[model samples]
Target: MGITGTRQAYEFPAGGAPPLGEVRAWLRQQLSDVGRGTMADTELLTTELVTNAHEHADGVAELRVSVASDRDVVRVEVDDRRPHLRPRRVTKQDPTTPHGRGLALVEAISTEWGVATGTEYKTVWAEIPVL
Candidate 1:
């Protein structure tokens, strides 16, 4: 027998902040039957990616999540209208600087992550081993 799962898509307004608690709760529910280790990383990475989209993008952002057991991977992609402003590794002298840590956190937590650019938008995506 094979394990089965699904994918979901969500759209967030341009420059609009998503309620962190609500998003986290929704993810918890979605991955309720999965193991704790997978769920923890998924939630954290999702929050970071979505928050980054809201902060940096000029127009609406979209989130797509896919859960699949065959591949034993949970994938998340956050799409934003600003393709030019790709996430970069910044070395900041002031640790007190309010921004620039999102990608670092994502890189730390996810198994693999990268960026894809289209003419109209860009997507930052991460994948975690779910099995």
Candidate 2:
């Protein structure tokens, strides 16, 4: 049996932080049939991507969570109206910086993650294996 499901679009104000707890709870309920570890990781990565969109971009932000058992992966994407702020891997020498560590954490946890840019918006996405 293969699992495949997707949640409806969630829209939030740009540069405005959404409640992480609420998002996690909703995701938990949606993915209840899925494994707990995979669900937890997906929720954490989703929060990171969404938080980045809210803090760094402007206009509006949207989120989508998709699970594909055939592909053995769960993907989370955060879309923002601003396409100018490209997502990049930060290489910081000083560890004392007050900010700029989100991408690093995302990379450390997710199996793979990157940005997809379109004509009007950009989506930062991360995928974690469900095995």
Candidate 3:
């Protein structure tokens, strides 16, 4: 992920609801602290994952960030407690998807992404690489 670039993590309580705005701000700060720009794509994708966790998942364990030395690539992960209910894949983007309630955008912006489900939790991660 990085030789001497960025590798950081944040933990949030997954009691009642996940605070989307707070999470975003923290992410931006972390990126900025490491001299990463917090580009639009990274911001948007991370928000999506967090929102999903807020709405569907039961508990959020952590948010991890990893950046390449050149800062040309970054990976963000949202880990939540709900291994059984992993994120579902959205094959098509519905033009009229309410306000924002789908993985379609994540699928579009992420360079690569997937879900990791363990016994007690599941993580939805997306990687954004600068072109």
Candidate 4:
């Protein structure tokens, strides 16, 4: 059950709109193919994380996912070119605002989340519990 090897993964352009629908579809297909059932929140999780990276760094250089079945956790990370810009916690949600809620949603749902800063790129990662 420990992640001996990679379960599944996908990648996108350095700074481009990652085909959201395709990403979601592929992930769901993979999950189901592996007999892990289906995680309903995956779509939202991917969207929030990807959109957060996209909105901030104009897009992500690449996105990665690693699942540790032993730990029952799925970690998703998005790498961006801007190391200075990291994800911040949003204290409150404004129903009127059209933007600025991705992190809040991410925080609300993720089992654990944080940022990994590198000299050239930064990766925002989140862990989702699997049942």
Candidate 5:
């Protein structure tokens, strides 16, 4: 992990998601100014993005977590080598199942979110407002 200004990034050589607990703790530490509610939302959304990339986009290549200079939002991005894969929201969810609800949680909680693709990688990102 490296930090500069308001941003911190982690690069994974093994090409997979890092442990969710570690990521959440890192994010929480970065967000000292935010309330517990905002921190929870950020953690949950970041976990969803990372988990989705690991499961669907081959694996995660990097994870970037940044807070706006003005502290208006915290943005979490998960990058993967597979540029062809993108996140999709599941319209129909089964009550008994634990899968297929990540993107839906992202959509509901993130203030803004989207994907960016390069020649060899795609980054799925979400921004949660600081409250």
Candidate 6:
């Protein structure tokens, strides 16, 4: 069955953001109807975005996952409090360092991705095509 019009939103709690594993689990459950490969790709990209938000922007304000009407793509968006810090892919990554590879991974795997800046927050979104 297709997941058209299916959407889920997660707002960060007051205490702290949920564990990355929990987020992945939730996403896996939500996208279970998609192919395994597609679900894995979505989890990886979603984790990257959530990790970036926690590491760079203090914390994530919300997370949204939605399937397009045509069921051709899944969109994952992570919103953070810092509007000025837009995500960008690292052109030159250092093998020695573990930092700065998140956006690069997102760029490589996502069919299309971009940042949306609100007055008080910014959202990094990626679209993964369903295979």
TM per candidate? 0.83, 0.85, 0.79, 0.85, 0.87, 0.92
Query: How many pairs in model 6 have backbone atoms within 3 A of each other, for residues 3 or more apart or on separate chains, i.e. clashes?
Result: 0
Deviation from native of the Cα of residue 34 in model 1, angstroms = 1.6
Expressed as tens digits, the lDDT of each residue in 23-85 for candidate 6 is 898887777788888898999999999989998898888889988957589999999999998
List, residue by residue over 35-112, the lDDT tens digit for candidate 3: 444456778888888878878886678888877766567788889888889677765556776744458789888878
Residue range 24-79, candidate 1, lDDT tens digits: 78777766767888888889899888888777775447777787677778888888
Off by over 4 Å in 1: 1-5, 13-15, 91-93
lDDT of predicted model 2: 0.77
Clashes of each: 0, 0, 0, 1, 0, 0
lDDT of 5 at 88: 78
Task: Supply candidate 5's per-residue lDDT for 70.
Answer: 63
What is candidate 5's lDDT per residue for 8-110, written digit by digit as tens?
7876658444687877877777676778898899889988888888888787888888877565777888898899876777898899997999999999999
For candidate 4, the TM-score is 0.85
For model 1, the local distance difference test gives: 0.78
Q: Report, for every candidate in turn, its global Cα lDDT versus the true structure.
A: 0.78, 0.77, 0.75, 0.74, 0.81, 0.86
- Which candidate has the top score in lDDT? 6
Q: For candidate 1, give the lDDT of residue 9.
A: 72
Ranking by TM-score: 6, 5, 2, 4, 1, 3
What are the clashing pairs of model 3?
none
Worst 10 residues of 3 by lDDT: 30-39
Q: Which residue pairs in model 2 clash with each other?
A: none
Model 1, residue 68: distance off in Å is 3.4
lDDT (10s digit) by residue, model 4, range 6-81: 7455777554577888878876765553334325665678788888777778787776776776676777787888
